[model samples]
Target: MNEDLTFLVLRQLQANPKQTQLQLSQAIGISVGRTNYVVRALIERGLLKAEHFRNSKNKSAYAYLLTPEGIDTKARITARFIQRKRAEYDALRAELDQLTAEAEAEGLLPQ
Candidate 1:
């Protein structure tokens, strides 16, 4: 659950990291409380950081940004995700091929 939440938050942030927590919650369709919880966890994990700055419209707001360590961790997590996906794809392909061969041998598929 944490991994899924982290990935979802990362994807959302990657899209528009300048968004405030409220804005991010709106964009991501999550409750503000949930977003805050996840964001805080990410910050604690060293996967995110924020700097408060006065916007033209709001004086007490923050903009979250990824640190160098955050970027590195993102890269690593993305790579691992792709690798796992590829492995699943390969496994599915093998299973499909095996099923096809079995069906063909059983005259269930066209020669």
Candidate 2:
């Protein structure tokens, strides 16, 4: 359960609460089972709420939406994720610079 993917899933649900797990799986490129698992986890965590809606296509199915708590959680998690990734990118760039400097000093690569 990637936090990024989880946030994206929540965002998607926010956009279209009526979208089915099957549809979400297709959109997210994940399996239906994984989507179901994540959705159930979100419900258990009080991050999502589902309601049964009667549409022309399906009468007995439900759709999902983020709870107020879910929206807050999504924002927090997404911000943290972005910060972490940016830090990682910066660290990797620093490491690359060090390696390049070492290589140039050793005459292993062109300056």
lDDT of each: 0.81, 0.90
lDDT of 2 by residue, 2-107 (tens): 8888887998898988899999989888999999999999999999998888664677578897999999999998899899999999999999999999999999
Q: Which stretches of candidate 2 lie over 4 Å from their true place?
A: 96-111
Model 1 C-alpha lDDT per residue in residues 1-111, reported as the tens digit of each score: 356557667877877777888888887778999999989988998888877766546665777788787788777778888888899999999999999999999999997
| Predicted model with the maximum TM-score | 2
Q: Which candidate achieves the best lDDT against the true structure?
A: 2
How close is each model in CA RMSD to the real structure? Answer: 3.2, 2.8
Supply candidate 2's per-residue lDDT for 45: 90
Question: For candidate 1, what's the RMSD?
Answer: 3.2
